[model samples]
Target chain A: MAKYLLLKHYRGAPDPVNSTPMDQWTPDEVTTHIQYMNEFADRLKETGEFVDGQALAPEGEWVRYDGPGSPPVTDGPFPETKDLIAGWMVIDVENRQRAVELAGELSAAPGAGGRPIHEWLELRPFLSQAPETAE
Target chain B: MDERLLRSLIPDTLRILIRRGADFASAEDAVQEALLLALHRWPKDPPRDAKGWLISTAWHRFLDAARSEQARRRREELVLAEPPPGPASGKDDSLQLYLLCAHPVLTQSSAVALTLRAVGGLTTAQIAEAYMVPESTMAQRISRAKRKLAEAHFTEPGDLSTVLRVLYLIFNEGYSGEVDLVAEAIRLARELTKLSDHPEVHGLLALMLLTEARRPARTAEDGRLISLAEQDRSLWSTTRIAEGVNILQRALAQDSLGEFQAQAAIAALHADAQAPEETDWEQILQWYDELVSQTESPIAKLNRAVALGHAHDPASGLAALAQLDASLPRHTAASAYLHELNGDFATASRLYSLAAQKASNLPERHHLIRQAARLSGTDANGPWPGSGE
Candidate 1:
């Protein structure tokens, strides 16, 4: 089995086809979206595919070490200006095709007006344990 | 309790049982049962003769199993059919087992799994965990492989090259979960040498040993790939290097040269050097030339170019690489290295990033991206502060 990371972006991605802001949606709609995501994770766990899922706070600051014994420098929490990561779910599945199929389902999570979000989720494969016979 | 020693005896004992009268499947099951019994009993009461003990125990297990399944009349016939220990056969049955598992009808994956179980003496659960497959799946694969081996009507021994290929694949998988495949491959290769004194068998063992000796130096503390030129020589295992070189010399004395021998020769040169600058790239390039001609493998050719770059001019190396298909996995990486050597950091950095994107493994991708960052004058000593790297 191979592992894949399903990334939901807060920004940086090209505007998703269904560009409805979560805050603008009805409270019930937001609840539905959250439930769909939770259900997806639960289903993956049942299949022995779920590895982990985590959400990130939108406000993030970039930091760098100045030098030894020096205070580190930090940048702004520019949530709106830069592409921010929303959250990610890691799954261990059979193959790339299966990973894509799951990603498609995730993208179809309900949104405003109870319609599919069509959000573009980034699907990245985890570099597996190196197989024999290196090409 | 010297489980490895017990494991080594597994195939030989199984073969002995089969030769006496036991069917292959029954014999295998008996051997497995004997091994489990050994694991439980050996530590408390070690066997004076492990192989003999296993053989007798497996034979008894086989008899018991056969008797339980059939009538008393058939059990008596099985007892009568059993052969007493006699002078060893000129052709070792263990060798036959190798040939059987390496049968060409089986795919590489199946052959590897079968050889690990029947020949290398790994348990199905251990093999499954190593390959990240379910135990049931690996069990099925091995059974299917054995069935395929049984069905193939090989009038003579199967291809020795196929056996060597499977062993090499197992070695390359390295250690994960319960199985240390590198050690397993080395153990199997050593067994192969005992059964058949073939030069290529020695060559393959030597190659694996020489390469594995340098494994400790192949990665940084942070798990990034360390190029040969940068690795600390002190970390290389001298004992394994000596053994590998000794084996290679003996194989060379036989004068039946093969691709594995040539590859080992290259590895030996790398191992022999005190420092990267002391490497005999000229001799390495010559060995790679022999390797390219013998195997006609693109990976060998790509490596040959890298050796060419170290031995001669970067331009010459680039010229050789240009002849290769660009779509090849390592082509961009090779080009980037050669370009970097030629002092074209601009192109090198770009190509390094491109190679990073195309890399199949995390360490390799990180290494490539680090190379790009270094070339582009970006501070890479700090932790990766962004998502991509």
Candidate 2:
């Protein structure tokens, strides 16, 4: 078994088939999209593939230590920032193919006009301890 | 009265009940209940016939369970058709349990969880914690596995190789958890040895031991991955090395070489080295040749390229790598290493960064980032290069 993180980047990633933003979509479309997400997670739970998932807030700022005596520095949430993550889902599956398949299915969640979003999902596997015989 | 001794009795204890015509799921439940009773009463009131005590208790429970279910009559007939438990059956039961738990129809994860529960005698919670899954999720996985086996109706013992593969997965596919999967794998391998005369079985055990011997120096106190070239040779377990070599020699003498034996030979060569410079890369490459020929596994081919770097030269390694699929896991890392060996620091640094981006685990990613930063004249402990988190 292997664990994979399916990442949903709000920006930086290529445009989806359905490019309309969620805020621009009709209220009915938004509800249907959300329902699809909930149903997808429930199905994964039944299959025992889902591990964890969360939707992130759009707002964020960069924080850093200033110096030995000063408070931490906080930078603006610059509009110019190109990278933005919408959410992520963690899954444990039988193989990479299964992980990719599930991610593809999730990417098919209904979007604007009640059609598939076809969003690009970044699938990454978890690094584990090198097996004893790997060396 | 020892916990390990109690656990050691589990597989056969459960198997005997199943052999007496109880279904796998019911037999398991009955055995669990019997085990709980043994744990409670064994310390103060030990049974003289522990195995017999477990079987009778579990069998009674199974029968009682069958009575409550609708298919009670048919199940009772199945139990009645079987011969009474004989001493000769115990040895085969253990192996059969391994076969049943690791049946090919089930997914790898399901087989692993089932094996840990039925053969390794671990609690569902314990298995859940080890795999880093929720207890409910693990429970579902195990029950689904049992259901799948029942549907498959596979009664004959499965191939030994499938069981070996599952055990190998158990040993190798571990990161961090309360349970020590490595030791658990070795224990199961040892148990297998008691039932079979297969040379490959010993080969697997030897491979695990020889590899594990180097674990003392595999990581630093702060949990950083240490390259093999930098590992302290003095920290290696000589006892384990000796035992492993002895086991490998026995397996090799049979002259029926398999993939695990070939890999073990490579590990034995590495273990034989007293220093990094003293490592027998030529011998390692040779064993890798045997391994590649036997399995044709892509990972083995990738590893052979790495061995070529040291055995011949970095140029040959780079040429060999260029011929293979670039998308293979660790391909970028191998390229970076060969470039570093060829004194192409810029290329190595770039590839290291790329490899870091593709790294699957946090520690390996951190290590690769550290490598990339070190080569590029940046802070070795710099923040992530391409990670979104």
True contacts preserved, each candidate? Answer: 0.00, 0.00
Candidate 2, residues B1-389, lDDT tens digits: the string is 87677778889888877766777888987887788788789999999998889889988988888887746466657666555665766778777788888998989999999998888877777789998889999989999999998888776558789989999999996647777889889888989988887999999999999989999989877566788888998999999999999999999999999999999999999999999889999989999999999999998999999899999999999998998999898999999999999998877877776776567765575566556755754322222212222
**Candidate 1, Cα interface RMSD:** 16.4
**Cα lDDT computed for each candidate against the true fold:** 0.81, 0.82
Q: What is the number of residue pairs that collide in model 1?
A: 0
C-alpha-based local distance difference test score of model 2: 0.82
Q: Give one digit per residue, the lDDT tens place, for model 1 in A9-106.
A: 76777766666544334435545665677688889999999998776644468899999999999988675668777679999999999999999998
Q: Write the per-residue lDDT of candidate 1 for residues B1-389, one digit (tens) a residue.
A: 98798888888788878778676666877887788888889999999988999899989998889979786557767656545545667356677778778888889999999888777777788899999888999989988777776566565668899999999999999875677899999999988888788899999999999999999999855455788888988999999999999999999999988999999999999999999889999999999999989989999999899889989989999999999999788899999999999998877877876776567665676577667766754322222212321
TM-score per candidate, chains pooled: 0.72, 0.72
TM-score of 2: 0.72
- Cα displacement (angstroms), candidate 2, residue A8, comes to 12
Query: Which residue pairs in candidate 2 have backbone atoms (N, alpha carbon, C) closer than 3 angstroms, thus clashing?
Result: A127-B360, A127-B361
How high is the DockQ of candidate 2? 0.02
